[model samples]
Target: MSATVAAILVLAVGTYAFRLVGPVLHGRVELPARLQELLAAGAVVLLVALLATGALTEGGAFAGWARPVGVLVGGVLAWRRAPFLVVVLGAAATTAGLRAVGVA
Candidate 1:
């Protein structure tokens, strides 16, 4: 196999093994309540960090005000429990409108 294919196979197997480890060890390892709560909070923080990074940067630089404002509109709709379609469309429209007016 080509080097790239071999590397992909190795990564796929490694990912599967890591996934299997969780199910295999489930119920066998008991985590402390505080640790569990911290883990949950960590997951939320990680997601928010990812969202911010994606929204605020492009090519290692600022993505411009348009993208972040679009994200904010979507976030507000989501927080208000808007439907998924409305959230996505609202963000897209906000970004497109701003770009149309040369905000970026």
Candidate 2:
């Protein structure tokens, strides 16, 4: 197999193994309350960073204002407890409308 394919297979196996290890060791491992809180906070920070990067960037550069505006709209809808489909469609429509109006 090509090196790229082999690397992907290895990563896939490693990911599954790590996932399996979590459940298998769940009750066997003990974490302090502070550590648990830190882990939770870390996960939230990680997700926020990922979202910001994806929403605000393209090819390592700013993605223009329209995408960020669309993300903001979707975020507001989600905060208002809109349905998942509605949030997604609203974001898409907002982005499309902005682009159509030459906002990007």
Candidate 3:
């Protein structure tokens, strides 16, 4: 099949599988502790992977300063346990201010 057709089939199958999982798992069986830990770690791993990849890209292979600046500010904000909205706004403002002044 063509790539587009294959993609549609995969998406449809995956969506149906997940939608089925909810009803199939409706208090039928409790998640094992090990499985729970693995699931939690999987989420964290995916988040870190995305950040290390190009979630905040400027359309290049790490060719922008906004990402690093935002990461630093966000890291600091998290380290200090600041509010989520404030941390996000601070990161955006830092990236915007830096780019506006031609730092990137």
**All candidates in order of TM-score, best leading:** 1, 2, 3
TM-score of 2: 0.82
Candidate 1: the clashing residue pairs are none
Could you estimate the TM-score for every candidate?
A: 0.85, 0.82, 0.68
Lowest lDDT block of 10, candidate 2: 64-73
For candidate 2, what is the lDDT? 0.97
Runs in model 1 deviating more than 4 A are 1-13
Residue 88 accuracy (lDDT) in model 1 = 98
Which runs of model 3 end up more than 4 angstroms from their true locations?
1-14
lDDT of 1 by residue, 8-98 (tens): 9999999999999999999999999999999999999999999999999999999999999999999999999999999999999999999
Give the range of the ten consecutive residues with the poorest summed lDDT in model 1: 95-104
Model 3: per-residue lDDT, tens digit, 1-104? Answer: 89999999999999999999999998998999999999999999998878877545656666587668877897799889999998999888888898889888
The candidate with the higher TM-score, 1 or 2, is 1
Q: Report the CA-based lDDT of candidate 3 relative to the real structure.
A: 0.85
